[model samples]
Target: MTTALTLTTGQDQDGAPVLVAAGEIDMSNAERFTAALSEAITDRREPLVVDLTAVEYLDSAGLAALFHHADRIEVVTGPLLSPLLAVSGLADLTTVRTR
Candidate 1:
């Protein structure tokens, strides 16, 4: 597919898992995003923090990927994505922090 998305998984200073995403996340790359997210969900108990600060664009397919695993994932967002997260009701399923 297209190289419009990038995903990386690592631990934060506190050892919490973090998934960093960048580039456009739309129908073209949603599957890639979903696969990355699925692989990142290694710990079913602990929350997975997704840093979307670098995500410049997102669409329903991309958002649905998050919703599919919203129960175990937390979101780190910004003005660009916060409103969409809230409007899509994803904010209710998990903690969404604005940055």
Candidate 2:
């Protein structure tokens, strides 16, 4: 079963786009996350900043979604690391900034 993933959007002081995601991102819900990101970038024409601080887990499907849109999005996460991106070897390919 696909768990519900929470996605929130906001802008920085300079109008930079930001998306805050809080939930598990696995095969079941990867599409939902991708759709949310697609919506965030549609028409707005701004680089996306994804805050994965509250994300507890991530999987290959989630990484694929991010890779598909790697050029348009920047990812930021909290210190506690999850091996999903690292194991997928996308930590360097995408804009994943850890805090």
Candidate 3:
């Protein structure tokens, strides 16, 4: 079965666009994740903050989605997912912080 995921849009303290995601991001829902990122990026036209602290799993497809939008986004994830982001080389392309 496909894993559960939720994507919510909002603004940060500085009024920058933010996309808060919860649950797993795998091939089953990677497309939806990418679409959300695309929408946030297109609508805001600025660096979007992606909050993934509550996400439990992210597969290669999810990573690919992030890479596709690497230039226009920052990532905030928990320690569990930090190493994956760093090892995926996404940390080099954009800002990724662990919380």
Candidate 4:
């Protein structure tokens, strides 16, 4: 079964566009994640803030989707997923803020 993923669009304290994601992000829901990323960046020039602080898991498919948008996005993640992002080399490609 597909893991539950929720995507919500909002602004950060600094008024940057933020996409808050919660739940597991695997092959089953990676497409939806990609779509959300696309929508978040539409007509926007500044880097999109992807708040994955509440996300519990992220698989290869999800990581691929993130890689596609690395140049145009910044990531905010919790401690649990910080190592994964670093190990995946995403931390080198963009700004990753751990909270």
User: In model 1, which regions exceed 4 Å deviation?
Assistant: 1-3
Residues forming the 10-long window of minimal summed lDDT in candidate 1: 1-10
Of 1 and 2, the candidate ahead on lDDT is 1
Better of 2 and 4 by lDDT: 4
Give lDDT tens digits, candidate 1, residues 8-92: 9998898888999988899988998999888888755688999998898889999999999998899998899999999999999
RMSD of 1: 2.1
Writing each residue's lDDT as its tens digit, candidate 4 over 6-62 gives 999999887789999999999888999999999998466779999999999999999
Q: What's the TM-score of every candidate structure?
A: 0.92, 0.81, 0.93, 0.93
Q: RMSDs, each prediction?
A: 2.1, 2.5, 1.5, 1.4
| Local distance difference test, each candidate | 0.90, 0.80, 0.94, 0.94
CA displacement after TM-score superposition, residue 46 of candidate 1 (Å) = 1.3
Tens digits of per-residue lDDT, candidate 2, 1-99, equal 444679999887879888888978888888989998888874567678888888888777888888888888888887664355666666777777887
| Candidate 2 accuracy as lDDT | 0.80
